[model samples]
Target: MINGISIYEILTLTTILFFIGVYGFFTRKNLITILMSIELILNASAINFVIINTYLYPENLQGAIFSVFIIAVAAAETALAVAIIINLYKMITSVEVKGTELMKY
Candidate 1:
């Protein structure tokens, strides 16, 4: 047991979260839902890094640093995505994937 939680348990939870994110991204039609799923996936990745670093190698802070970078990137991505979604909504008045198919104009 590392940090009071088993590594196996952490891995299992992360795996489950990753799959849920995948399912959400693929099944949801709304742009906002897809963005939520992407965030979930990013969170799972961040959790995995911190857990592994805390358990396997407590001497260094590389994992934590990478996690921070990932979070920063995610934030930037979210901001840009939301902006694009807003623009698309203004153009078509819908957030559905099908509605974006006409963005060619």
Candidate 2:
């Protein structure tokens, strides 16, 4: 174990979580599920960023600040996306991935 936590262990865990998010994003057809997957991916990224920052610059707190901002933005995005999805569902009676594609035009 390095630094009381093996580097390999941390990397492996992060990789697994990232791939799980990717799989969810690709396999899930519902808009909400896709949103959740996106959130998962964002979380994984934040985790990796924090770990790297802590390892490389233990004295600086910039990474924590950035992570907080990321969380705020992700929360806002999820709120807005959920509202839009609800509206779309009300109009189409469904929240499937392709159901809202017509809104593009």
Candidate 3:
């Protein structure tokens, strides 16, 4: 437990967040929503990494380092995904996943 918050509680929160992201990914038809869901999933994992590392090996920085890397990658991914979604919107006038099929030859 860290600061009176049990690791199980934190892990449970991460699990819920991850499942919400999964549910959103499956149910949302909009590309932007899908991207946001992906971000949520990434964030949950990053949080899990940091929390577990802090609890299991307080002296080691590997968990925190990996979490930072995950955040950086997620930022780049969001930027690239947003750019793609914008271009797709311009071409199809919609950001729905079904609209992307029109781009295929």
Candidate 4:
């Protein structure tokens, strides 16, 4: 129910969400949290793309298609991340930050 809110407001909100995601990705130490933050950033970009396309070019559906692709990619990314996290947890029994440092050469 945002009355009189212009397209700029929507873009601003998207930018804020994107920055929040960037902050979370930078600040979080846990792997899962980082992955979630990445997803958030992706979602923010997708939303902004869709909104811009819908408002500026109402005839084209390319933005919607791109958003769908983003969703699919996000789903695949989450699945892979979960699998990796589970394997890491099984190996160490703890999914804490710096747990994978041992893998570094």
Candidate 5:
């Protein structure tokens, strides 16, 4: 246990966050909402990495390093995704998933 919270409890929270992110990703139509859900999913995984690493290897910082890397990658991914979404929205005037299908040509 860390900070008075058991590993099971922490893992449970991460699981809930992961599922919420997954649900949002599948059900949301707007590009921005989908992007947010992706971020949530990424964040949950990062937290899981940190917590599990800390619990299993109290002396090692591998999990912390990985979480940092994940965050950096996620930021870059978000920047690129937002740019693409913005261009798509400009061309179609809609950010819905169906609207992007018109760009398939």
Candidate 6:
């Protein structure tokens, strides 16, 4: 237990968050909502990494380093995704996922 919270509890919460992200990603039709869901999934994994590291290897920095790397990658992914969405918006004027299937140059 760390700070009165058990690892099981933390893991459970992360699992729930991950499923929520999955659900959001699958159910949402909008591109921005899909991006938000992707962020949520990435965050859930990051949280699991940090939490496990804290409890299992308190003296090591690998978990933290990996978390930072994941964050950096996530940021870059978000930026690129937004840029794509913007360009798609300009082309189609709509951000719906199904509608984008027929996207033209």
Compared with the true structure, what per-residue lDDT tens digits does model 5 show for residues 38-59?
A: 9999999999999998887778
The global C-alpha lDDT for each of the candidates, from Candidate 1 onward, is: 0.93, 0.84, 0.92, 0.87, 0.92, 0.92
Best by lDDT: 1
Q: How many clashing residue pairs are found in candidate 1?
A: 0
* C-alpha TM-score for every candidate: 0.92, 0.83, 0.92, 0.90, 0.91, 0.92
Evaluate candidate 5 by giving its C-alpha RMSD to the native, one decimal: 1.9
Q: Write the per-residue lDDT of candidate 2 for residues 38-59, one digit (tens) a residue.
A: 9988888777767766776778
lDDT of 1 by residue, 37-85 (tens): 9999999999989988988899999999999999999999999999999
Task: Judging by TM-score, tell me the better candidate of 5 and 6.
Answer: 6
- Residue range 1-105, candidate 3, lDDT tens digits: 458888899999999999999999999999989999999999999999999998888888999999999999999999998998888788889888898674576
Clash pairs, candidate 3, are none
Supply the TM-score for candidate 1: 0.92
TM-score of 2: 0.83
Across 11-101, the per-residue lDDT of candidate 4 in tens digits comes to 9999999999999998998888888899889999899878888777778889888998999999998999999899999998877777878
How large is the C-alpha RMSD of every model relative to the true structure? 2.3, 2.6, 2.0, 2.0, 1.9, 2.5
Give the poorly placed runs of model 1, Cα more than 4 Å off: 1-4, 103-105
lDDT of 2: 0.84
User: What would you estimate as the lDDT of candidate 6?
Assistant: 0.92
